[model samples]
Target: MIGEELEVLYEVDSTNEFLKRNYRSFHDGAVVVAIKQTAGKGRFGRTWYSPEGGLWYSVLFKPKVHIGLHVYTKIFSVSIAEVLKKLKVKVTIKWPNDIYYEGKKLAGILAEAISENNRVVAIVVGVGINVNNNIPDELKDIGISLSQILKKKVKITYLLDEINKYAWHLLVTYRNEPENITKLWKKYLYPKEGAQIKFKHEGEVLEGTILKISDEAMYIDVGGKVHVVQSIHELVE
Candidate 1:
């Protein structure tokens, strides 16, 4: 069972960091959550703003060797999106792992691998959802909370449980039926096929139309030339 053991903290530097540092001490399904994170982390060395009222947590999982680390981020993110939609939040996913509502970010995820001898042994997946937390006016254009969208405060415990339940169900489905998970996740991804997009490549920005998205890369038609966008950071939007 996922998240069968849990740890709740008042504050922490980073929920993901806590799990990684103590990776050996906890069981495979253990989870760690914090009310506030002073030094939250984001993708590509960016900082994750995790103030009070958001759900900041990490899950420890030791999966099969063939599993790609990136898949955890995608899987968990879609689970979050599913839960929000049930609340009538109308959430959508940004490829590679982010939840957005009307172009503003609602959540982000970070999944790291614990490796030994060049082989991944475990993964720590951290998730952050902007719930009832106050967003500064300057950052309001890029961030939003559940309360802001629903016009009411969402109970933190209830939301957390919903997310965990959906995630675990999807995980089990993935293990038993691996073929359809990707399509299910892609159903909510934004910038759908044929959308015009821009990105930085080799220090120069290029424009393109999204052709297709595979697990490892997004095939884009740039000036009639297909350029594979393998990293989410390559996207300019």
Candidate 2:
């Protein structure tokens, strides 16, 4: 029953922030959607380009597992990719959380956790997808929308329904067999074969080949040395 309790706003600062402030009152599977976001956020304090014509929403979850927030992000990424594929949109996920279509970013997912007294409380997963919006000049080269790809206006209601359906299915799979989530994520990873990948760790660029990926980290072969990347600031492929 994911997204059973949905709150749609005409405008908001950030859906994730909104959920965090009101998390104590919301139940599991509650969702907050904003038609337009003034201060939407992305990973690492980046601003998420959210406008009226995009799908900007966040979901609240009370997971049984306390740790491994990255796993939840992977689950959402896979769910969105699966839904878009069914709509005849070719999409691939970049390592971590960015969704790409024809090498341009289509969507981004951010996961935030709330804890008290060293105990887990709730998790908020925010997603921003460009549907019928016109790409701003700054993002014109790197951002793309569903309408742009399909050359026609897409129905936002149908897309939201599909996303919620797949999200619930993946959430169930995650609670049952978490390893399958990693497998599905890797299966849809962009540049699936050997390719040069670079990520910054500890203020240093670590370039390598992506050997394998798990829920927590990525194993990379860099200069004959295997480096475990737990957190990446920038990823280039």
Maximum-TM-score candidate = 1
Worst 10 residues of 1 by lDDT: 63-72
Residue by residue across 1-237, what tens digits does model 2's lDDT show? 778898999999999999999998888999899999999898888998899999999999987766478777888898899999888897998778889998789999999999889987899999999999889998988899999999999988788888888888887757667777878888898755466788776688778997877655678888898878776445654
Q: Which stretches of candidate 2 lie over 4 Å from their true place?
A: 64-67, 198-207, 228-233
Which lDDT value does model 1 have at 150? 97
Per-prediction TM-score: 0.93, 0.90
Number of backbone-clashing residue pairs for each candidate, in the order shown:
0, 0
Give the Cα lDDT of each candidate.
0.86, 0.85
Question: Where does the lowest 10-residue lDDT sum fall in candidate 2?
Answer: 228-237
**1-237 in candidate 1: lDDT tens per residue?**
777899999999998999888988899878899999999998876898889999999999987645666677777888898888789889888887889999899999899988889987779999999999998888898999999999999998888888888888888778655556777878888877888989888899999999998767789999889999988779987
Q: Which candidate gets the maximum lDDT versus the true structure?
A: 1
Model 2 / residue 1 / CA error / Å? 1.1
